[model samples]
Target: MCDQCISTVAASAGSRRRRLWDLPHQCHCPLVGVCFPLSTLRQLVNKALGGKAMADDYEVHVGAVSECLQRNRLSELLQKDLESRYASTVQAFRAAKTTKELAGLWADAVRRGDVAGAFWAALTHPRCDEVLQEVVLRDMHMLQHQAGAAIRVDIGKFNLLLREHGVLARELGKAQQRCTQLLAEKSAEIEQLNSQLVQQRAATIGKETRIAFLLQDLQQLRASLPDYENTSRLRKQLEQLAHRQAELETQNAQLRQQLGQAQRALSLRGPEDAPALASEPQQDPIKEAPITLHLGKKTVLCVGGRNGNLAHYREVIERAGGQFAHHDGGLENHQGALDAVLGAADLVICQTGCISHNAYWRVKDFCKRHGKQCVFVENPSTSSLSRSLQQIAQVP
Candidate 1:
C-alpha cells in the first residue's frame, strides 16, 4: 500500500509540472519554451494557489510573459483570438495613409499576435519590420503609377478628339463658302436668263403688230379691186398725156437752142454787155423749187452715225446752213452727254439702225416735250440727212 501511494504522487507531480509550463501536447519535449498562453492565465493562477512549489514556478513564468507583453504593448491585444488580432493589425497597417499612420506600423506588427510570437517576431528578428514596410510601400507606388498612366492615356485621347473637331470645322467652313459662291453664280445666271426672255417678248410683240398692219393693208387693196374699169380709163388718159409731154419737151429744146445762139451773138458785140450779162446770177434748181427748205443757222443733233462719215456729214450740214453735233450711242463715249447736246439743238435726226434704244427714246421724249421736230431715218447718209431737212421744211 505505501508503494502504490509513492507511485501516485510521482504521477501527480509530473502532470502538474506539464500544466504549469503549458506545453503543447504535440511538443516533443518540455524544455522548448517557458511562456504560457494569456488565455490560460486564470486557470493557471487557480492551480498555482493550490501548492507552494507550482506557485513559485507559475509566478516566475507568468511574470516573464507579462513583462514581454507589456514591453511590446500586446497586453490588451492578446485578449482577442489569434486570427482576429492578426487580421486587425494587417487591416490597420494597410489602411494607414499618411506618414504619421505609417510610423505606428511597427506597433501594429508587434500586436499582430499574443506576446510570445509577436514580441519574438518584432524584437528578435533583425530585418522583418523593414521588409514588411518596403513591401507595402512598393505596392502603393505601383498602384499610383498605374493610375497616372491611365490618366495620361485619357488626356491623349481627348486631345486627339479636339484635333478631329478642328479639322471637321475647317471643312465645314470651306463647304459653306463654296455653297455661297455657287449660289451667287446661280442667281446671276437666272437674272441673265430673265433679261433675255424679256427682250424676246418685246420682239414678238413688235412682229405681231407689224403683221396686223400688213393684213389691214391687204384687205384695203382687195376692196379696191372693184374699180378696175375706172383704172383702164385712167390708163388711156395717161398714154395721151405722155405723148403731149414729149411734144412739149421737143419744142422747149428748140426754143433753148435759139435763145443760146442769140445770147452768144449779143455777148460777142461788147465787153460792157458781157460784164452786165455775167453780173446776173444763175438760177439753182434746189433754190428755185416750189417746196424749198433752207435751215439757216439751225442746230441739228445727228444722233448715232458712223465716225467714218462724220466729216462728210459736217460739210453737208454746213453747206445747208446748219450746225451739226453727233453721238455714237453708247459704243464709244459716255452717252450721258447726248442729252445736253439734244437739249441745245433745234432739230433731232436719229438713224434707227445705228442708234441704241435708250438714245432713241430720249430724243423722242425731248422732241415731244419741247415741241421740237424729230425725224427717224433708215440710213445715216448725207443724202438722207438732206432729204429729212427738205421734208421738215415742207411741214408748214
Candidate 2:
C-alpha cells in the first residue's frame, strides 16, 4: 500500500457514503440494503475477497470514485497524504540505513497492509531506484576520499624517490671529483714515467747508435787492413775447398743416377727380380730416342695457364692425337666457354693452378653431370710432355 492507494481509499469511502444515502426505494429492503460506514465496508470486503482479484476490484472502485470526485479537492487530499507519507518515509529511511532493516520493513508493510509503510519500505530497499541512487552517491563520496588519501601516499613516495635521487646525484658528483683528482695525480705520475722512459729510450738509442758506429768503424778497419797475404792464403784454401766440393758434387750426381737406374730397372722387372740381381749393372751412358715427338693434329681445351704455357700445352695436345681449343678471357665468361668445350670433348683435363674456384666447381659439375672422365694435370716440362704423349698413345 502507498500514498496513492490510501488517497484512493479515502475517495472511495466518501463516494460509498454518498451512494448509501442516495439508494433507490425499491432496492432498500433490509437484506439487500447495506448501511455500514465506508471504512467498515472496505474491511468486510478485504476479509471476504482475498488475493489479486479482490485487490484489482478494490483498485478499480477507488479509481472510479476518484475520477468522479471534484478534481481540486481530490488533488488537495492526495498532496497532503503524499507529503505526510513522504516525511514519515524519510524518517524511517534515515533510521534504517542498512539494507537488511529496510527489507524487514518491506515484508512487514506488505503483510500489515499499510500504504505509508510500503512506500517507506520501497524507498529504503536496496533494489529500489531511490535507495540505489542514495547508495551510489555515498559510495562515490567514499571513493573520492580514498582517492585523496592515495594521492597523498603517492606524493610522499614521489618525494622520497626524489630525495634518494638527489642523494645519489650528490654521491656521484663526489665520486666524479675523486676520480678527476686521481686522474690528475695519475697523469702527473705518468708524465714523470714518460719522461724517464724517454730518457731511457734515448740512452738506449745512443748506445745502439754508438754500437752501430763502432761496428761500421770495425768493418771499415777490417776492410782497410792489408789483405793481399790473407787473400792469397784464403784463395789457396778456397781452391782446395772448391776441389773437395766438386768431388762431393760429382759423387752425389753419380749416386743419384745410380738410384734412378735401379728404380727404373726394378720397375721394368715388375715385382719378382729381387733375389736374382745380386750383381749390379756396370755404369753406362744414358741412351736417347732417335726422333723427337711432333704435334701435327689434335683437339684439346686449354683452360687456365700463362700464355706461353698455353701455347706449349696446345702443341703437346696436338702431338698427343688431340686438337687444341683455347679460352683466354675474363673470369666471368670463362665458365661458359669451358662448359661448351667440355660438352664437345672426348676427355677433360683441368690445369690445376691459375683456375678460379668457381671455374673448377663448374668444370667438375659438368663432368659429373655428363659422366665424362676429368683429369687434373700439373703443367708439363718438355720431357714430361713427351712422356705424357707416349702414355696417351698407349691408352686403349
For each candidate, the alpha-carbon lDDT, in order, equals 0.58, 0.53
Model 2 Cα lDDT, one tens digit per residue, 1-396: 455434433443231211211222221221011122345434434443442234454563454244323434332333333345456664565454554665565555545644333443343233333343244334334544666899899999999999999999999999999999999999999999999999999999999999999999988887787564445544654565577667778989999999999888778894456556655676888863322334345355555555435545655676555787654322423344466667777656666565777787777788899897655556634344445555555566
Query: Backbone clashes in each candidate structure, one number apiece?
Result: 0, 7
Please give, for residues 1-396, the per-residue lDDT of candidate 1 as tens digits: 255333333443221211211221112111113134433544434444443333455554445344332223233222233324344443444454433454455455434523333322221122223334344334334544666898899899989989999999999999999999999999999999999999999999999999999999988886878544445544654564576667778989999999999988886787767777789998866752232666788998788876556666777677778887776665554566666677889888888778788877887888899898889998987778777778888798
List TM-score per model, in order: 0.31, 0.25
| Model 1 CA lDDT for position 197 | 97
List residue ranges in candidate 1 displaced over 4 A. Answer: 1-291
| Displacement of the residue 40 alpha carbon in candidate 1, Å | 40
lDDT of 1 at 385: 72
Colliding pairs, model 1: none
Q: Which candidate is the best by lDDT?
A: 1
